[model samples]
Target: MASLLAAVVSAVVLALSSMLSERHCAFGFGGFQCNDPVAGYGSVLLTATLASFAILIVSALIATWKLVAWFRAR
Candidate 1:
């Protein structure tokens, strides 16, 4: 259950980070564009996404371990 919760949280964070990274604004006339400085194409976003994936993997492993243990116990 804990691992499942962690996986869900990480998935949410990954989705939010991906959305923030893609956020942009367009200007009129000149057709200029602006992106969020914090989340725009950079290492920060990449790191966040990677971290989330790592957490997800860890959670999945934990869940699998618990499942296997349960099956063995029964």
Candidate 2:
């Protein structure tokens, strides 16, 4: 349970960081261009946020599921 909560939190952080690393300009680019510093960084963060946290989220879910199963088995 604790680990799952942690994973959920981690996912949220990664997702949010990935989003914040980029500065969205509604008027600067006239909403036509998405201006984000170092496209590479944004891409990397997005990938990491999705991939790395995906792993954690899956693992955490599995752990919780197993825990539940174990408890129910008893």
Candidate 3:
């Protein structure tokens, strides 16, 4: 149970960090418009979001597997 809670908290933190960083970007101007000469900002954000979600999913799956095993052991 503690592990599950920690996993959830970590996931929430990851999501919030991503959101805050994205908000700080200068691309808030009309519809994803980034004036920076750097390329792949959007792609980077997409990758981060996907990675975070994947971690959250894996954590949840592990928690579920643990719970099932514990129940079976009873």
Most lDDT-accurate candidate: 1
How do these models rank on TM-score, best leading? Answer: 1, 3, 2
**Candidate-wise lDDT, in order:** 0.75, 0.62, 0.66
Q: Model 2 reaches what TM-score against the true structure?
A: 0.47
Candidate 3 minimal-lDDT segment of 10 residues: 31-40
Q: List model 2 lDDT by residue over 1-74, tens digit each.
A: 66667677777777676565455322244332334554335555556567757767786887788899989999
TM-score of each: 0.65, 0.47, 0.52
RMSD of each: 6.0, 5.3, 5.2
- lDDT of model number 1: 0.75
Model 1 CA lDDT for position 46: 61
Give candidate 2's whole-model lDDT. 0.62
lDDT of 3: 0.66
Error of 3 at 68 (Å): 0.4
Find the 10 residues in a row with the least total lDDT in model 2. Answer: 25-34
